[model samples]
Target: MPKPATENLIEFLSNIPFFSEVTKSSLKHLTTVLERETFRKNKLVFEKGSVGEYMYIILSGSVKVHEKNHVFGHMHAGECFGEYALIDSNKRSASITTLEETHVLKIYREHFFQLISNDIGFSQGILSVLIKRHRNIDIIQENLASSKKALELANSKLSGLIDGAMDAIIMFDEKFRILLTNPSASVLFENNDVIQRNLLLFLDESSANRIQNLIKNDLNNDQPLSSNYLPDVIKVIGSHETETLNEGTISKWGDNVTSFYTLILRNIQDRLQAEDKIEFLTSQTEYLKEEIKELTSDHGIIAEDKSMKKVLQLVNKVASTNATVLINGETGTGKELVARAIHQLSDRKDKPLIRINCGAIPTNLIESELFGHEKGAFTGATATRKGRFLLADKGTIFLDEIGELPLELQPKLLRVIQEGEFDPVGSSETIKVDVRIIAATHRDLLQHVQDKKFREDLFYRLNVFPITVPPLRDRGNDICLIADHMIAEFSRELNRPINQLSKEDKAALINYNWPGNVRELQNLIERAIIISQNNSISWQSIIPQGGIEQEATTLQTSNTIYTAPELIEIEKANIERALKRTKWKISGENGAAKLLKLPPTTLASRIKALGIERPI
Candidate 1:
């Protein structure tokens, strides 16, 4: 028979470079200690979520490394894994499996732990593994970079330099094409993306002609054109590059020779009028628009309706004042979006805007959730943790569903809002924060105050500049406007090409009384887009509440407008279907209620009244 398989593996191991230098006595011991294990083709050596205790060294055959939605990469012989765990003792990042029958040196961490306890050199070897792997990565990166062309590297380096530079910078190529723009450069151009675009795009005909003439003159003189111009506020918020651009002429033509010049516009209103709010959009709701645009961007209302637009105007007016703003609106009216707009429009845009839904968090944990807790604060408090309020210091804290705050915790929140002081659980020290509060609620706080459930003092503090966002059903023409935007958004997100919504779907949208408001409308649109089999989204594709009953009645009575009360049954049915699809989960915000765009509280109410099972 062949020399034992273990002996053959021992012989193979002696030839590998990383361990080849070991003495014969050490090699024999290492061989004897390592258990030889065979994994057939496609056998799972380790999985992404398992707790690992062994460092595996591939001696024969290869394995694949795969990340979610990423390519399947390979690891060849002499490679090892379960290595990072040795350093931080964290969970595995990805799974590994053999492509063919494989053999590897399985070094159990327990055995290595014993070795480390007894020998200092063995400990050093384990530490050296991480150092060696890091060095190998550096070498591979350098080798790949060395093969890159000088021009490409120069361009990449220039981009990084521009982002870091205080002043804005813009570059143009010899053919008058836009080459690059830094963050500060965007701040100069009305905070818009003009980079990689034609130089002639942003300017009017007169300005373009004037620049053409000036550039032509500069080329004839073989000099650079220098002029002071008003920069757009949009550009300032966009890029933080250099304020001046230098474009040396390569080939200057006669009057307007084939040439490109880099022009730097300065935000003239920066110091004068405070153009921080210039980037605030008052068109369609940005949240819904961004959703349609496949961006997880915040929402805002730039209402033109005299009543609602006043909220926008007020938010802008007090935004720089750094005062607390309490916004009250119905469930789907975009309260958190307003909070974000306030933060962005304030001086603390660079800081976090931590948000918490007071109602969703259990009353027992609310104290620890908002004020943090020390290690051993309670049974599961194994480590010290920072709470939402502490994390939001120096920035803004948006408390959504503020009315749902527990009756007992209400006083502590009142103290924080009024005195800016809070104590972590089981800690004697009171932490003071320089935080701005922006609270929102769909419930009637005045009633809660009367019932002695809410603190009136806190209400008055946050109600400094009260803002009310209009419901989606009340936006008139903006409904169609938002729908078109959402269709485009969901199409891109789902990677589907839904060219347009069917007339029936459009009619249904307009007729349907969106009790959940804008949020509900957006969710329904997304659902239709995701389920649409064709390029066009139709009403039938939308699974409403009450199933066939709702669909038949809604389609039959398409001529009649749906009132909130009338569609109550239909909404209930749709909610049930959503819950079934999600296996009756109310866990993450992506559950049936969230997917339906209904407030979690509101969804819960319907769930109980309808006897829908709660999976928590």
Candidate 2:
């Protein structure tokens, strides 16, 4: 006889998503009538081209989800599957097998259909779920059918992303062909095509043979011998020679069960790029910043083109003069650096060069920051203090975000510039001093002046000389020069002495248009440095989702099923899940620090230093 409904636990079923919205009595009846089945490793829960059978609720353990290409995803407890085949009657879209000897709650097709047909809400919900899955698969299929060479080029580009992949990437056949490779993958194989033929066939019967034998024996068994010769996970720390087995389970599949899935090959490279773009755009999202470590004060500040050189000559001509300078450029084009340079080259370089963001400063306090104040000047005035102008007396004051200044303050600024005198709030005493102002704004101040939003006198005074910084796209070999500088900076910061970018890394950085400008370059390098394991940085470490990766996989997930990008996106999601589960603390006994098997301090520092914002 079938086992009794143990512990009268229909209440537990009532809370499960599959049963949550259903009536409690219905849940009880379903549970009482269900069969509990156990499956062992290598057992096919369902197979490709197989008939529609039962749908399973994984009360415990997990199953591997393998598409035609390979293991595309994994399914864990409480998630339902086989519903696709059950409802559609199509061939099993993907083959699923037990990752371990797992116990599952199996609902036969007849009973499942009966329950669905009997309950309107339950039946509709199940149909909705199937529709979504079917639509997703259809989108993916359409994308694959879109082209031939285009798909390969896209996939090759995606594979190029794995060169310095922090997570170890392995592409192995059910037999012994090592198809997948990381930047470091070449370390052992020397040539990636080494995986084309069987390992024994390609090698001269030494290390490859030994590894092949080990792989063959372990995967052939019914149960994964975790303590024995089973293939484990891999973690990389930027060294050319260090190899490791990372945490998380690696299970096998394919007709004979020779294929395996790993946690090491996360799509972090593309995802990190996406995160940087999102983070960079949202300036206040400061917890995870995207301002890549600038290579040098000189990098990308001045353009080499003659047209750009004309602008620089103008900046230098007014550098020694006391006249105010207005600097303008697209955001992220190093306008701020030009402002600094103007101050450095000026006569007042010896004194303080006070930098204040007129826009960033709150509207309520714009006046207080620009003019010195006495005690009891306002409600929160705790003490007398010198404002930025007072601090910048006998020197230069850089007024960034000048366009954001209210109309009320523009005239006062113009007065201060013309008269060299101003009184603080609630005080009659006036201080007089000589200060040259350098104002920089991404906004068109002239347009503001036209709208009477900016003071014309102030504009005329500040626009005496102008400097326009060039974007990265216009820079020449300076690209490699900057890249070289980044190599040194990142290598030292990461404590890994990466001497050069792989040919691919150099090419991608040079060809791609850096919308974030020098800032984007710096962020990419910072991320690569944090995760890079090579003596030299690899192309894989720096490929981001926004650049070429997006061009290839950007639309892969939405209404379409672009597999690689979609999978990478999913990987990014899982990392967020892991970080959330670990509470953003990558280290410590209960943290990812312990699970990654890294020192708590190391993991904590990495989390902090890398700016990983958990998806909570």
Candidate 3:
């Protein structure tokens, strides 16, 4: 009784489970409410979390049910999707996408409910399908939860292993864009913002070129996704433009459409430095030994005066400790001798004692001389060289003339003292050393701090144990002893028969203020020995006629004579002046302690000893 096309539609509806129990009359009525829709392949039918308003049945092609990028199931022709919409108006549990160009019959929720309510048989049949789908959904949810939990556990373990690795691990795409990086990789590159950046940005030109070639060769050869070890080391440049040698492997993964690469690297900078350090220290030690033999007397430091004995006592007390010593004295007063004594007595005596004169080096090169530089860091930096700090690792470094250290570079020295770490000039990587520091200076560092020529913090850091070497004039009778010792040595060296100094010679030497300290006495003795006649030294010839009187007059005019009590008063006054200048601040950059070039604790002790106090 129906048209041919209508009869075909009725037959299709009759075969479906929902309408199988319905009467022939109901099947004919269902065709009127069903709407036919067509979709292109890969077209989105409905997205997860969207409102569900219609139920669809595949009529010609297949459709995929997925969440995010993972496909869970597929439905071919004669299969139904969005069936839950007929029972309730909840959000879609899964997204539907056409796997191919497909035709589908869609029924609105209102029409679907009307057909179920109008016919009891159809309603029973629909309920049966709903119960079965519910059971299937429960099973799928349990399996999905188990799979999600397993995936999370696996990912966590992998992440922990990668993060805990000491070697740097990085992941990148075919274009060399960074996809992920571990903490070690971040530290090696010296950059935290490496993600989404090009890998070539962190490598030197040669390394970048080589890496590109390697990748191209592998791709061109159609090699399978596998790892390949790089035999040669690669040079990586850090954020500070410092270069380091890294050894590692590169691996490729993923299909042809989307390729990924993983780079695993280990930094070998420390190992290379260790090898170079041994050679450098061996040479440096031999050179220093020769220098020591030439400069020092056979009997070592000759001291007899009470002041010199006290200086030696202080040196002995502090030599055992790793405390930084600041030897304050005039030039030619044997400050280097005191430094050598400390190093020779310390626990680190077995290690090298490296000395660097801050003022002796040029201003432009002093930084490199202290912290070192990489090759090509600047003009003339042809080969990488270790600085004095690196060479003095586990040893003592005597920073002579520390007051002359440039103000800009003081912070780096402070970092080394405070943190035991420093970055070489023109390098980003930080190098750590376990070197003890012993600084010496003839300049008044306190005055230098007030003049803003030196860093206050650095002064405090270096002044941990202050040892003031008495000048030649202040050492009392030590001058005569040193003179006699020098005279014997110089006489022997010059092949002169002058064995001793006369009473008059001793008298003149004692009376005259030797402004040049022990060094001047040595020189005078050497000259006297060279020009002596008849195996006798003449004091009159060397002293000139009025030299002693003139020196006495000069000393008197300069008011240089001070007793122990007078000297103490003078020191107290100087500290008070600095305190008042700094508004009685005892610590910090602008504090009185810094102005006086003393540690805060030392300054406080002195203030207490001197009974000095702030204004009421």
Would you list the C-alpha lDDT of every candidate in the order shown?
A: 0.67, 0.64, 0.82
lDDT of 3 at 555: 39
Model 1 residue 277 CA deviation (Å) reads 32
Give the TM-score (vs. native) of candidate 2.
0.41
Q: Over the stretch 289-361, how does candidate 1's per-residue lDDT look in tens digits?
A: 4224322233345455565667778879978877878788877667777788888999999887777778666
Q: Of the pair 1 and 2, which is ahead by lDDT?
A: 1
Q: Which TM-score value belongs to model 1?
A: 0.45
Error of 2 at 137 (Å): 99
Where does candidate 1 have its weakest 10-residue lDDT segment?
275-284
Candidate 3, residues 119-154: lDDT per residue as tens digits? 776677667667887899999999999999999999
Residue-level lDDT of model 2, residues 176-273, one tens digit each, is 55565576545543454544555344334343454455556766663443333224322333223333323323344455534543223332444556
Q: How many angstroms is residue 190 displaced in model 2 relative to the true structure, after the best TM-score fit?
A: 95
**C-alpha lDDT of candidate 1 relative to the true structure:** 0.67
Could you tell me every candidate's TM-score relative to the true structure? 0.45, 0.41, 0.49
Backbone clash count for every predicted candidate, in the order shown: 31, 14, 0
Q: Name the candidate that leads on TM-score.
A: 3
